[model samples]
Target: MYYKYPNGDEIYNVMAVYEAHEVYGIPRINDDEGLELRYFSLDEPIEELNPFTEYYLRKAGYINKW
Candidate 1:
């Protein structure tokens, strides 16, 4: 899955989708994707994600205000 940032930068392979709390279970791979990633807490529900992640999550059928 490919997605674009708000600045119009494009990213290839949006990677895997997992439940928010399950994120830690995901393996840490090399920086092959070249993305600068940061962890956010879905438990908070009030936190907002970057546009690209939000868009990808929505397209993947994950619905949340953030």
Candidate 2:
């Protein structure tokens, strides 16, 4: 999926959804930056989303609006 920032930047292939209230994936940055499994909630808005998680949720049809 695509991740968008409030500053108008974007990153792609950074996420995937497999179940309710959770998202599973990692941002594909430089290999030196490494990777890890990150989580996001669909049950409620997250205050520290970097703004991208919500955008993904909405774009993927998991949410209608913020």
Candidate 3:
């Protein structure tokens, strides 16, 4: 997914998934920066994730049994 900030900056390749805490969260994709990304509740939309993020999530078994 892509997050367009109010300042016109864009964050690409975002991913959102369910967490063990029973909430949805967006993990940090920037390993080098060690950024703590945002988290969204179940009410939020997670279907807007990017292709690369989806592939990695699936491969890592974050989501399965499709």
Q: Could you arrange the candidates by TM-score from highest to lowest?
A: 2, 3, 1
* Angstrom error at residue 60, model 3: 0.3
| Model 3 quality (TM-score) | 0.34
lDDT of 3 by residue, 1-66 (tens): 667999999987645555657554556576677555666443433567666765776688664654
lDDT per residue, candidate 1, 1-66, as tens digits?
A: 576899999978645655655455545558797565556554354255566667776777574555
What lDDT, from 0 to 1, does candidate 3 have? Answer: 0.62
The candidate, 2 or 3, that scores higher on TM-score is 2
| Model 3 alpha-carbon drift over 4 Å, by segment | 1-45
Model 3, poorest ten-residue lDDT window? 36-45
Best by TM-score: 2
Q: lDDT per residue, candidate 2, 1-66, as tens digits?
A: 676999999987656567644434663556766565445555667666656667777878886645
TM-scores, one per candidate: 0.33, 0.38, 0.34
Model 2 off-target regions past 4 Å?
Answer: 1-13, 21-41
Cα displacement (angstroms), candidate 1, residue 4, comes to: 11
lDDT of 1 at 14: 43
How many angstroms is residue 62 displaced in model 1 relative to the true structure, after the best TM-score fit?
Answer: 0.6
Instruction: Write down the RMSD of candidate 2 (Cα, Å).
Output: 7.4
